[model samples]
Target: MMAADETSARLTAVLDKVRALGPTLRERALEAERAGRHSDETIADIDATGAFEIGSPAEFGGYEFSVRQQLDVVTEVAKWDGSCGWTVWAGASTNWIPAGSGARVVEEVYKPEWVGPRVAGSSHFPASRGRAKRVEGGWQLSGGPWTFGSDALWAPFTNLGCIADDGEGPYLVGAQVPLGELRFLDDWHVAGMRATGSVSCKLAADELFVPDHRCVDFRDITGGNLDNGLKGSLWQAPSLGWSFSLMAGMSIGIAQGALERFLERSAGRPIRGTTYKNQLEAPLTHLMLAEFHSKVQSATLMTRANAEETDRLGVLAAAGTPADPDYMQRFSARVLVETAYAAKWCAEAVELLQRNSGSTAIMDFEPIQRAWRDARVVTLHGALNLEALSENYGRLMAGVQPHNFAGITTLDRFAPTAPNKAV
Candidate 1:
């Protein structure tokens, strides 16, 4: 482990890197959005900051920054460009392969070192796309065109979902496969988050062979039952649950961006049909700004709360005591609820600002408009939707397991899996 001061210094450097890159990233935001992909320069700039390697193991030359640090950087980047933030999170997604059943394979994947390669993964509900047949040397993987294949264009290997061909006890399995084996569908067309390049792709069912070394039973990954090598490691912390905090951080940034733009654009502008020459002169505008400020402040508090909890749990995991199931549920639920609510708050805050700013601010090309769109789109993520999250948390309290979630038909639908212990 890094000494406390060293970790602080490294985190500060990374935060500074993102802060310095903000202007350039924001300058090129529209260009990346129109192209539906990050420019090579943009990706390189962010990667240079080590934002993508935040969760990597220390042995592999990774900084192994804490979850709080990861979310801090994520929030900072998203403030500049929404897609860039999502892509950075995707870049770090490989850090969570959950070492138990696939420990050897994961070790082999990172054997060469952890500097540049992009790692992408997919996990969808019900295992509808693929089949896994146990072969002599490994599993024969057939069928996939997995959705949510973020960073697919740059990633060399993508962990794909498949179901083992057991007669009565078929199980879900994950196999890391070469991106070349899959064909893309060019989908990801959305209102906001347009630059994410999150398109659907196809993998031939049963055509590709996955050696046993590259496979992990979804159950093992979910339960954090990895090899001894990772018993007391930060990587043992479940990655899926962190998705909430990741999204929460992004929400905080998007809201912050919107609020900044709102203040900049509103203060000097004249309000029509009013005696006031500028928005800042109006008592109502002062009230409006105060309320919006309060909203962002509250949302940011929740966002920081999620990040702190993640750090606490990570420390426990690193100390050889995995997080308790109930605590995980509360944290996970908080992530979903807080991120979604924060994103929604940001979306509405911008909408209110946009409305009060008069006709000129209504232009489609406006930055506040962009922030509004981005926040709205971010809140639409399956894991970040406020309604679904509230219901899930409520159901958890009512004794229904999240495994029985409406969209989830099976237990392994989500992985780096969590325990099914009573909530």
Candidate 2:
């Protein structure tokens, strides 16, 4: 891996490139939304800019940029279009699977180019369904359909979330299965973020061989502590910590876009039957706009602050510097909590923006309406479930079992990533 600064600069360059393509991406948004798949032209444009592999580590032609970078880039793209932003997130996030697998594994997946997998963090465990069986070199996997396989269609592989029964107890693990071995069910019709093309994926009794190296033991990679066998600063945050930051970026960007549309529409627009000439001149309008601005600004600040802390801790871990272990534990918990807050404020802001948008927002073609829907849908991601993460953080503070702390898949009803440490 090259020096961290060089890689981060390259990642930033690509993000800037993506931002420059906003007009093209914006033009393709409705088409992608209607098709429930990103347009080939949009995909090609994203590919040309290196946005798809932004999450890749230094080992494989990737930047492995910090949490703040990831979130910033995703948010920048989402500011113009949500579907494209989501596709970027899905492609970049899939690298997490290979990052945990190891360097060689990542090389194989993106060797010639950056075609990669569509990973689902949550799924019906293979062992739970009796579909994973011990084989000579490794385990053979077969399973029924699983829903919410986001960004699977364009990818050639699938990261199947599973629980491996080690006889003593079941361990949370992830299996990288070939896409050729899995069947994709075309059923992604939805109201918002329709461009994600998140549909159900199915695998029949056709068992596929998966080598031991392709499996990621969640406990081993928790707190973003990926053992890449290198001194370079890449892919080494407590497990999945960066993901929340990226989600926060998307949440905030969507709300900001909605606000922009609101402002544009309200410039000289008037309220019905009111003595006030324009919404901009009315006291209630001033209050509403101020409320939206405050909520979104606060969300952006908090999420970015979390990103900075994440970067500090990640850099320390990568350099083999001694970091305060207590801080790391509490940091991850707080990042999740902050991430949920960001999502909450984004949703609230969007809802208000849409409400004040008047009858025009109901025109189906209005950007604010779609932004409202997109914000709501993205916040529903298991990782961003506000109430659940808040409670988990509280439990962690009380020195109690903070749910999903590993032990069994059944331990936490809603944890998307395995805990960095056992409770």
Positional deviation of 115 in candidate 1, in angstroms?
6.7
Candidate 1 lDDT over 298-391, as tens digits, reads 8778877777777777777777676666656656665677777887876777677777867776565566677778778877776665776777
TM-score versus the correct structure, for each prediction? 0.88, 0.88
Write candidate 2's Cα lDDT for 26-145 as tens digits.
777777888888866677787777777666655555666767777777887888888777777776654556667665556656665644333433363433332455577877766646
Candidates' C-alpha lDDT: 0.70, 0.70
What TM-score would you give candidate 2 relative to the actual structure? 0.88
Task: Tell me the lDDT of candidate 2.
Answer: 0.70
Model 1, residue 184: distance off in Å is 2.7
